[model samples]
Target: MMTKFKRLALAAAFGTAVATSALAHSSKETTSPADGSTVAQPPEAIVMTFDAPMRITLIQVTGKDGTNYPVTRTDNMAPSKTFQAVPAALPDGSYTVNWRGLAEDGHAMDGSFTFSVGN
Candidate 1:
């Protein structure tokens, strides 16, 4: 049995613990160059960075028309805090980068983003 005052204290402690745990969970904090950025020259590679370390298994870049870009290189710079992939110079028009990875907590993350190349 618990009194009203005791119940309130227990509730507050539980809430604080939950909130702290949630904050500790791995999440995407930032991305280099930002999500949607226009570059004057074609980028030598495509990189998607995250806050927590991720196990990136696959990454693909495709032209606006859906043609897969030639992947020249792919590297996991830091498996604990970042995931990156590099490719040759892309052609003009819009391009999309599709990535699949496992978060530090073992959860899978899959998403895509598009950017432009030239005039």
Candidate 2:
């Protein structure tokens, strides 16, 4: 038979483990120009919002024929809940945004999405 105090302690430990696991991987909440949508004009910067704060380790925007676009961070040192990158003028073509980052929970996460610039 388990004592009341032991049961309470077990419950608390379980809750903490569940919460930590829930935040193990951060996910993208939104993006500038969005994913899989066409835009008339090229966006000066690509911004990404995550469910939790993160440090962006790498970001890249690539176009067709394996062409890589220039990307720079708005802030270099600090981790943020939001991340942004400036890309060179994207000509009419399909492009993919690829990124890798560390979540606040210390997990390494990565994601990529595609979009079109024009017809």
Candidate 1 Cα lDDT to native:
0.70
**Global Cα lDDT for candidate 2:** 0.87
Overall lDDT per candidate, in order of appearance? 0.70, 0.87
Tens digits of per-residue lDDT for model 2, 1-119: 99999999999999999998986777899988799988888988899998888898988899977899998777784678889888988999989999999888788889988888986
How many residue pairs clash (N, CA or C atoms closer than 3 angstroms) in each of the candidate models, in the order given?
Answer: 1, 0
Error of 2 at 83 (Å): 0.8
Candidate 1, residues 61-97: lDDT per residue as tens digits? 8887878886654453235566555666776677777
lDDT of 2 at 43: 87
Q: How far is candidate 1 from the true structure (C-alpha RMSD, Å)?
A: 2.9
Number of residue pairs clashing in candidate 1, backbone atoms closer than 3 angstroms, sequence gap of 3 or more or interchain: 1
Off by over 4 Å in 1: 29-33, 70-78
Clash pairs for candidate 1 = 53-80
